[model samples]
Target: MSEAVQIASIKDDGAIPVYVARPAAAPKGAIIVIPEIFGVNPGIRQKCDKWAANGYLAVAPDIFWRFAAGVELDPDIEAQLNQAFGYFQQYDPADGVYDIESTIRWIRQDAGAIKVGCAGYCLGGRLAYMAAARTDVDASVGYYGVMIDTMLDEAHRIANPLMLHIACEDQFVSAQAQAAVHAGLDGHPRVTLYDYPGMPHGFAAEMGDRRHAAEAELADARTEAFLAEHLA
Candidate 1:
């Protein structure tokens, strides 16, 4: 099992809280785990632990720290979405990207880190794509990223390997939107896209009713393989 520790983020104003998981043995590399609309909740923390188990030092920065540090809203769609949306309305994606960039810089300074990659869910998935386009991480993976079809112009900027898992039946990311994304990124050398036939948004979340076991398992396996190839 990996141990979770609180780490300080590199920032101009003040330190932000980042949860890091280190493997029992030396790390093969490092990975940044971006959370969903909810902050660094149990699920996101578990992802950090999972990556650590997979041999990478994993870090999950509290991106919601700007609005409300350690804000972890409920996973219930009806109970939490309004609040999550409120936070989303207040949050800027660019700022989140900057925070991730800072986390990347932190990863670079780590003695155990020889290569760095990132993976994200929901809103984070979109940020993972942005990280691929903007940051210097070795690889990135995104799951059901929101509004990514609108940012197809940035596809060419991605030089590092990037994987995107799109939910075919996702209401948030409709079939048409997925097609647009495929149209723009289909032939990109560094971009790989995976489509889950009947899955909906948040398909990989343990707390959600939309979770699909088979698809999540397959996507995760692919993600690990992709990481192995690129972060090697």
Candidate 2:
């Protein structure tokens, strides 16, 4: 259902490698799967597959290809986690969002997709929020997105449906940040926010210690329903 593919990068003459998944039946729409700090690893690929199984064309781009390609880090490994954080420190979300914007354009023009949405995790979650405001993505969803509070000024640019899943006890995000997020966009007519009371930062991860089974399931179910409703 999924395979490695390439998308043309308008900024350059090269092709960007991407993991693409297609549904068994005709796709209802396309969902771009934005990866966490770990890049396009197995977990991220699985996310694309999950979306494909749900009747969407799922595409995951390598946002770190500007500096590194084929990155697959494990959070449980001390060294890898540190390396991931290092990459995070070096990554500029503005550049990453540009890649996301190109991906959306490719999905629409090259892939023949009628509707395109985005679902992002961790750092990707922040990009999802940006996409809601900056791109033509039909709908956007973010899970425990870090640093979103700092970009609240751009909330007025969000013209489509946007959703966010917040882990109430996320170690990476502070109480003040969460409150700011709520205060800034809680009343936005096109936005919906969900809070998971006892979840941690990566509670919805596909595997490992960060995965909180029940909470992840609940959030994913909500995401699927939201995507189906909006993209359809």
Candidate 3:
């Protein structure tokens, strides 16, 4: 069992809903777990739970609430893909940074989170990078983040520790885009990127058919290790 709490985000001139998970015991630090474009669904909740199980306070904000609240899509492949694209059309990297910043502030004030980190998947993955670039989070991790090619210019602002997990077989983001992201890092000592073969996008999600349990476990271990290293 885990402890869950409702969090509020002050963005878009109003408040947005968020879910927070933590162990019954005190937490070591705070982590902002960004959800995919599908919104704050079950998968994201499970992620928060997993982090909590690892002894951290994990919070996931509904970035889509600014456009539509309580919006959830079907899990079918085609339907999910279509809905994800539609959601992405309404949100930009800037909006993501704004909403995540609000969540970070809220956690710092309400949860007494002394250290902050971030991790996201797919669309949320890109937003993690944006948060690392624009916010004061101590660290960030992005798993197969799309649209990284377009945000390369902002990489210079990413002064915190950053980790990126890329799928070698990803069809959406090309090799050129990956290269651009690497080049944009420009000798950032705190940043590291990894490419995993035979894994598809959203591989970290255990709820979907594409869930590679082995790869997901490996990624989760890496994430835990990264958080331990940076958040400590």
Task: Please report, in order, the local distance difference test score of every candidate based on alpha carbons.
Answer: 0.86, 0.91, 0.82
Model 3 TM-score on a 0 to 1 scale: 0.92
Off by over 4 Å in 3: 1-12
Clashing pairs in model 3, backbone N/Cα/C closer than 3 A: none
Per-residue lDDT of 1-232 in model 3, one digit per residue for the tens? 4444445545547776788887768779888988888887888888898888888888888888778777765455697779878878888667778888888888789778479899998888899988888899999999999988798888778889999998877777887887887787747787888878888777778587868898888988898899899999
> After superposition, which runs of candidate 2 have C-alpha atoms over 4 Å from their true positions?
none
Please give the TM-score that candidate 1 achieves against the real structure.
0.94
Which candidate wins on TM-score? 2
Candidate 2 lDDT over 60-166, as tens digits, reads: 99988878888899987899999999999999998778888888888888568579999999999999999999988999999999999999999999999999999
Each prediction's RMSD over C-alphas, in Å, is 1.7, 1.1, 1.9
Instruction: Arrange candidates by lDDT, descending.
Output: 2, 1, 3
The alpha-carbon deviation from the true structure for residue 55 of candidate 2, after best TM-score superposition, in angstroms, is 1.0
CA lDDT of 169 in candidate 2?
A: 98
> Lowest summed-lDDT stretch of 10 residues in model 2?
7-16
Give the per-residue lDDT digits (tens) of candidate 1, residues 115-211. Answer: 9889999999999999999988899999999999999999989999999999998988877889999999999999999998888888898566767
- State which candidate, 1 or 3, has the greater TM-score: 1
Tell me model 2's lDDT, rounded to 2 decimals.
0.91
